[model samples]
Each structure stands twice: as C-alpha cells, then as structure tokens.
Target: MSGLLALLDDVAAIAKVAAASVDDIAAAAAKAGTKAAGVVIDDAAVTPKYVHGFQADRELPIIWRIALGSLKNKLVVLLPGLLALDAFAPWAITPLLMLGGAYLCFEGAEKLVHMFAPHADHEIEADFDTRDPARLEEEKVAGAIKTDFILSAEIMTIALATIESPSFWMQAITLAVVGTFITVAVYGAVALIVKMDDLGLHMAATGHTSGSRALGRGLVRAMPRLMAVLSTVGTAAMLWVGGNIVIHGLDVTQLWAWPYKTIKYVATELANALPAAQGLVQWLVTAALDGVFGLILGVILIPIATRVVGPAIAAIWPGKST
Candidate 1:
C-alpha cells in the first residue's frame, strides 16, 4: 500500500512537470508569434492575390494547395535549416535577419512605387491571357509558394530569435507551434477573403430577411476596400518591421548607434509629453521613425537592386528577370 502511494505521487509529479513544459511552450510561441506579426500580416495579405482569377469551385482547393506548400516550406525546409543554424552557426542569424529585413524593405518600396506611379500592366495582362488554364494555375501557385518561402524564412527566423527557451527541444516545439499556427492563420484568412464575395452573393440571394440581404450587399461592397486596406497596411508593416530590424541589428553589431538612440530618445520624449497615452504615444513615435528610416533605405536600395542585382540575377538565371 505504501509503495503504491509512492508511485502515485511520482506520476503526479511527472504530470505536473509535463503541464509546466506545455505552458512554457505556449508562452514562448505566443511571444514569438507577436514578434513576427508584421511578416504574418504581409503573408496573409499577399496570398489572396494568387487565387484571384481562379474559378469559384477551384478557389478553395488552390488555397489548400498553397497552404500545404507553405507548411512544407516552413516545416520541412526552413525549420531544419534554422535548427542547423542555431546549432552550428548561431552567430550568422543576425546577418541573415538583416538580409531578410533588406528584402522586406525592397518589396515594400517596390509596391509603393508601383502604387504611386502607374506603369504598364502588360506583363500581368499577358499572363492572364494565357491559353492554358492549368499551366497558369501551376505558375501562379509556384510563384506564390516561392514568395511564401521568403516570408516564411523571415517569420521563422524572427520567431526563433524571440524564443527564450534554454532547451533545444523546447525551442523546436515552440517553432513548430509558431509555424503551424501562422500557416493556418494566414492561409485560412486567405481562403475566407477569396470566398467572401461568393458568400455575400449567396446571402443576398437566399437570405430570408431584408437585413441579412442588406448585410450581404454591404459585405460584397466592402471586400474590395478591405483588400486595399490590407495591402496598404501590409506594406507599411513591412517597412516598419524591416527598418526596425535593420536598426536593431546594426545597434547589436555596433555598426551604428545613433539611429537606435535617436529613435528611443524621441519616443521617450513623446511618451513623457503624453502621460495619459504614454505607451501609445511612444509606440507611434518609434514606429513612425522606423518607417521613415525604412522608406529612405528602401528608396536608396531600389536603384541598386534594379540596376545591379536584378541584372546580375537575370544574367545568372537567364529568363528570370523581375
């Protein structure tokens, strides 16, 4: 009887320890997910466009395919690579993060230019005009997956950096959680966004009440505007997050101290000025400064990327010019 009681106590202790580990992983994943919010937002925003012209029946399947590809990118390819980096070349993480940041800046800047300066939509038009629907779908899915791979790399790296776990297993579990959660969230949102118009149409057609019909009409009208807003928000987020990452990276490496200190000083001053909204004011000031810095850096990088890097990549890859 005494021996049985001792075994029960041991089992209870083990259960408590397991529960604690689960709580720790959950906490770490939540924190890491927050840190990668900007990239996640952009990911959700960008994915819907890939399914834009697909047939109504095919939309969900296409989204599912892309979501699966995204999962594979994060789990099979990126997670293992990240673990290897953490194990062997941990010091390389910051520089790689900076590189990803530069990419985000470039992407945001390019979108800005395309938005403000109207250019020929010939390429897009031509792509849409293709005779082979299957080929077009494949190409679109492939392109989207490629884009997702870059964003996933950024998200995973950011999450890994944010995790505070001492155990390798804990870090691995946290990353898996982050990756699965982000993938499902982003693509699930994309699936909904793409089907919203159809849902609205159905509601308008079949709703039993006038209010339901009116609400459906409103949803139909609102989706395009919502998409536009999302795109704008995503661009801003990318610039803000990218600039902040670069600034912090530079500060970490002792390459530049003034930008970080200057931003902090300004934010602190604003926070002090508005005691009632101190936190909000400080965040806005910091984000605004970071975005401004990002815009400037992105503008500077645009010419170099287009003239030098673009051409070099095209030269190497032949027929893959952006």
Candidate 2:
C-alpha cells in the first residue's frame, strides 16, 4: 500500500509537469501569434477575392483548397526553412525580418495607390478575361497560394522572432501551433465572409419572424461595406506593423536610431500629458507615428518596386511575375 501511494505521487508530479509545459506552449503561441497579426488580418482580407465570381456551390470548396495550400505553405515549405535559418544563420534573422517588413510596406502602399490613383494591370485583367472558367479558377488558386507563401513567410518569421524559447523543440512546437491556428482562423473567417450574403439571403427568405428577416436583410446589405472596412483596416495594419518592424530592426542593428527614439520621446510626452490615459495615449501615438513612417517608406519604395523590381522579375519569370 505504501509503494502504491508513492507511485501515485510520481504520476501526479509527471502530470503537473506536463500541464505546465502545455501552459507554456499556449502562452508562447499566443504571444507569437499576436506579433503576426497584420499578416494574418491581411491574409483573411485578401483570400476572399480568389473565390469571388465562383458558383455558389463551389465557394466553400475553393476556400478549402486555398486553406489547405496555405497550411502546406506554412508547414511543409516555410517551417523547415525557418528552422534551418534559426539553427545555422541566427544572425540573419533580423535583416530578413526587415526585408519582410519592407515588402509589407510596399504591398500596403500599392494598395493605397490603387485605392486613390487606380490603374488597371492590363496583363492581369486580360489573363483573367481570356481564360476559361476552369483555367481561371486554377490560376486564381495558384496566385492566391503564391501570395499566401509570402505572407506566411512573414507570419512565421515574426512568430519566430517573438518566441522566447531557446529549445529547438519548443520553438518548433510554438511555430507549428501559431501556423495551424492562424491558418484555421484566417480561412475560416474567409469562408464565413464569402458565404455571409448567401446565408443572409436564405435567412431573409425563410425567417419566420419579421425581426429575423430584417436582421438578415441588414447582414446582406452590410457585407460589401464590411469588406471595404476590412481592406482598409488590413492596409493600415500592414503599414503600422511593417514600419514598426523596420524601425525596431534598424534600432537593433544600430543602423538608424532616431526614428524609434523620436517616436518613443513623442509617445512619452503624450503619455505624460495625459496621465489618466497614459497607456492608450502612448500606444495610439506610437502606432500613428509608425503608420506615417510606413506610409512614407512605402510610397518611396513604390517607384523602385514597380520600375525596377517588377521589370526584373518579369524578365526572369515572364508571366509568372507582377
């Protein structure tokens, strides 16, 4: 009986340790996931377009396909590459992170330009217009997956940077959690967003009560506006997150310090000025400054990306680029 009690105590201790590890993993995953919020939001916002114009019955399947592709991109392709970088070239992570930040800025800036000074990408439009339905669907899915790879790379790298774990296994597990969670959350949201109108329509048509029908009508009417809001939010988030990343990266590398220092100073002053709302004031000011810096950097990069980078990629990859 004494021996049995001792064994039970040992098992309980093991259970306690296992529970602690699970808690640690969850905490790390949550922190890392938040660091990649901009990419995740933009991902959710961008994916719906790939399913647009598809038959109603095909929408969920298409989203499922893209979601699977996104998962594969994150896990199969990016995860190992990132782990290798962490293991062998740890010093390169910051520079690569900043490069990802610059790409985010470029994307955000391009979207801003398109919103205000829209110009058709005749090649893209022509390609879509000329392709048969099946071919177009395939191409759209392919393009979306390609886009997801870049975004996934950014997400994974950001997650990696934020993870505090030094153990390789812990880092691996945390990244896997972040990747899987973000993929599900983003694509699941996309699925709901795309089908919302249909759901609204069905509710409106079949609801037994006037209030339910009215709510359904409201939902249908609200979708387009919701999408517009989502796009705007995603763009702003990209710029804010991207600029913040670059500023921090620059500070880390001792390449440029003033931008971050200046922002901190301003935020501190604002927080001091509004002590009652110190945290909010500081965060809003910091985010605003970061966003402005991002906008400026993005605008500057726009010409370089379009005039030089796009042309170079196009030369090498032909229709696969730009």
Candidate 3:
C-alpha cells in the first residue's frame, strides 16, 4: 500500500496547488474590482431611474431584463474585445479609457445642467411625459439598457486594465466575475429601491400594529429623498472618477502634467498642514480638484460635441443619429 499512499500524497499536493491558484484569482479580482469602484458606483446609481415610474408588477422583470443585457454587454462583447486589445494593441487602452472618461464627464455634467438649469431637454422632459404603463415601461427599459451598455463598457475596461493576469483566460474569468457580481449588486439594489415603496404601502394598509404602519409610512416618505441623494452622489462620483482618469492619463502620457501636479501638490500641502485629519483633507482636496477639472473638461467638450462630433455622426449615420 506504499504506492497507494504516494499516489494519495501526489493528489493532495495537486489539490493544494489548485486551491492556491483559486485564492490568487479571488484576491486579484477583489483588488481589481475596488480599483473600478467609481464606474461601478455610477452604474448602480444610474440604473434605478429607468424603472422609476413603471408599474409595480413589471419592475423586477424589467430590472432582470436589463441585468441580463448588462451581463451580455460586459462578458460577451467587452471581455473578448479587451483581451484581444491587450494581446494585439495594448497602447490603445489609455486613449480608450480617456474617451470613456470624457463620456462619463459629459453625461454627469449634462445631468447637473438638467437639474439646475432650465433648458430645451428639461422642457421636453415634462412635455413628452407618457402616462401609458406599457409604452412607458418599454421606453424606460430600452433607454436604461442603452445607458448601461456605456457604463458597463467603462467598468469592463477599467477592470481589464487593472488585471495583471498571466493569461487571457484568467483575465476573462475575473472580468466575468466582476461583471456578474456588479450586475447583481446594482440591479438587486434597484429592485429593492423600487419595491420598498410598494412594500411600505402594503405594510401601512395591512399591518395590525401602529408601529409597523408608522415605520412603513416613514419608509415610503424616505425613498424618494434617498433616490435624489443617490443621484447627486452618483453625479459627483462620475465627475470625480472621470476627471481623475483624464488627469492621470495625461500624466501617464506626459502631455499636460502641470495642472494635475499642482492639484496633487496642493492636496499634499493641505494634508501636511492638518496632521490629525490629514487623510480626510487630502481626499477632499483631491476630489474637489478632480471634480472642477471634470466640469471644465466637460464644458469644453460640450461645445465641440454639439458643433463638430454631433454633425459628423449625423452625417455618417444618416437616419440613425439625430
């Protein structure tokens, strides 16, 4: 039985190695996912508005559909593309990242403008309001999925850049995990946010106890305000992430280093000045500068986008673009 024991020992050794590899994968995935937090936050925040006015019965199903679409967007379309790009043309990633950053800044700034500034789109927002449940649901789902695709692309690209795997298979698996986890987390939260009102209403109507009814009423009242806060936080996150990416990209390329360097230096000086609360000061300073940079870049791009890229896209796509 010596040979049998040797064989068992060998098997045990192989299992140990396999376990190590799995642990490595998990560790890398967690770190990479953390690095992509801003895009992920923006994604989670943006998804809920799509199901805002849908009928209660249809909300979960709609989120499910969009979640599936998001999975397909990240895993099927983007994962392979990222791997291929890494394999063939690694240099394109920084530029593509900057492009995605610009889009995020534009989207975030547009939302800000829509909120505080009355404009053509805001007027249309009230004018073309649909009351039909079915039509409105379809339009909202379609729009949400389209927006999710852009955010998902950003998430995937950021994850791909952070992954330092030895093989494409490893990168693909990690990305798939990040994509699936993020999708479930975002949509699951969306579903809860959308349904908490109905749940609260039902509790108020049916609960036998006064305390339960009071809690339910509070929940119903709190949800809308919570959503508004979440949206504002999401916008800030987008600007912070986008501006940080652009500035970091510029630094990486050695193109325009002065502004970012100045920001970094000021942040460091502030941190040093306040030693007890150094970390908080540093973070706040960095975030503020990043957001301001994002706002300026977005403002500059808005004009160019409206006058130049918008026209070129319409010319190329003919009927598809507006």
Candidate 4:
C-alpha cells in the first residue's frame, strides 16, 4: 500500500512538472507573438485579396488551402531553418530581420505609390489574362503562399528574437506554438472577413426582427469600408514595423543610434506634455517617426527594386520573375 501511494505521488509530481512546462510555453509564445503584431495584422489584411474574383463557394476552401500552406511554410521550412540559425549562426538573425523589414517597407511604399499613381490601362490589362479558372486559382494560391513565406519569416524571426529563454528546446517549443497560433489566428480572421458579406446577406434574408435585419444591412454596407480600412492599417503597420526593425538592427550593429534616440526623446517630450495619455502619445509619436523613416527608405529602394532588381531577376529566372 505504501509503495502504491509513493508511485501515485511520483506520477502526480511528474504531471505537475508537465503542466508547468506547458504553461511556460504558452506564456512565452504569447509574449513572442505579441512582438510580431504588425506582420500578423498585415498578414490578416493581405490574405483576403487572393480570394477576390473567386466563386463565393470557393472562398473558404481557398482560405483553408492558403492556411495550410502557411502552416507548412512555418513548420516545415522556416522552423528548421530558424533552429539551424539559432544553433549555428544566431548572429545572422538580426541582419535577416532587417532585410525582411526592408522588404516590408518596400512593399508598403510601392503599394502607396500605386494607390496614388495615375491609373494605367496596360497594367490592368496585363493582369487580365484569359487563364483557365483552375489555373488562375493555382497561380493565386502560389503567389499568396510565396508572400506568406516572406511575412512568416519576419514573424518567426521577430518571435525568436523576443524569446528570453536560453534553452534550445524551450525556444523551439515556444516558436512552434507562436507559429501555429499565428497561422490559425491570421487565416481564421481572413476567412471571417471574406465571408462576412455572405453572412450579412443570409442574416438580412432570414432575420425575423427589424434590428437584426438592420444590423445585417449595416454589415453589408460596412464591408467595403472595413476592407479599405484594413488595407490602410496593414500598410501603416508594415511601415512602422519595418522601420522599427531597421532602427533596432542599426542599434544592434552599433552603426546608428541618433534616429532611435531622437525618436525616443521626442516621444518622451510628448508623453510629458500629455500626461493623461502619455502611453498613447508616446506610441503614436514613435510609430509616426518609424513610419516616416520606413517610407523614406522604401521610396529610395523602390527605384532600385523595380529598375535594377526586377530586371536582374527576370534575366536570371527567364519567365519566372514573379
């Protein structure tokens, strides 16, 4: 009887330790995930567009496919690469992060330019090929997956950097958790956003109450505006996050400190002035400055990317430039 009681005590202790480890992983993942909010938001914002022009019935299936691709991106490809980096060349992480940041900035700035640029019929026509529906879907999914790979790389790198754990296994577990959680959260939101109109239509058609019908109508009306807002927010987030990464990378390299310090100083001043909203003021000031820096860097890179890099890639890859 005493032996049986001792075995039970040992089992109980082991279970407690397992539970504690699980909690630690959860906490670490949540913290790490928070650090990549900008990319995550942009991911959620950007994914819905791939479903555009597809049949309504295909939207969820397409999103599911993309989500699975995203999962594979994080788990199969990026996770192992990141672990290798962590094990062998941890120093490379920051530079890789900065590169990803520059990419985000460039992408955001390019979109901004296109938004304001005079419309060109050729550009529209170029994209309006009479491809088969299935082929077009495949192409769209492929493009989205490729884009997701870049964003996921940034997210995982950011999360890896934010993790405080010194244990290799702990870091791995935390990263896995962060990756899975983020993929699900992002694609789940995309699915919801894309289907919202349909949901609203159904609600409008079936609602017995006037208020429900009104709310349904409101959702339908609001979706376009909501999508626009999301796009704008996503652009801003890319700039802010990208700029932050570049500045921090520079700081890490001991190459530049003035930009970061100056931003901080100004934000501090604003915080002091608006004591009631100190945190908000500081955050806004910092984000604005970061975004400005990102915009400038992106603008500079735009010509180089389009004129130099684009042609170079086209030359190398022939017809596979995209």
lDDT (CA) for every model shown? 0.85, 0.86, 0.80, 0.85
Each candidate structure's TM-score, on Cα atoms with residue i matched to residue i, is 0.84, 0.83, 0.85, 0.88
Spell out the clash pairs found in candidate 3: none
TM-score of candidate 4 to 2 decimals? 0.88
For residue 257, give model 2's deviation from the true position in Å. Answer: 1.5
In candidate 4, stretches whose alpha carbon ends up further than 4 angstroms from where it belongs are 1-13, 118-140
lDDT string, candidate 3, 147-218, tens digits: 677678778877887888787777888888888888888888878887898889988888899999998899
- What pairs collide in candidate 1? none
Instruction: Supply the global lDDT for candidate 2.
Output: 0.86
Per candidate, the number of residue pairs that clash is: 0, 0, 0, 0
Q: Rank the candidates by TM-score, best first.
A: 4, 3, 1, 2
- In model 3, the Cα lDDT at residue 314 comes to 74
**What is candidate 2's lDDT per residue for 213-250, written digit by digit as tens?**
99899999998788677668767877887788799889
Task: State residue 196's C-alpha deviation in candidate 2, in Å.
Answer: 1.7
Superior by lDDT: candidate 1 or candidate 2: 2
Between prediction 1 and prediction 3, which has the larger lDDT? 1
How well is each residue in 173-227 modelled by candidate 4, as lDDT tens digits? 8999999999999998898998998989988999999988988999999988887
Top TM-score: which candidate number?
4
Which runs of model 1 end up more than 4 angstroms from their true locations?
A: 1-20, 49-58, 120-143
Candidate 3: residue 246 Cα off by (Å):
1.5
Q: What's the distance in Å from true for residue 124, model 3?
A: 6.4
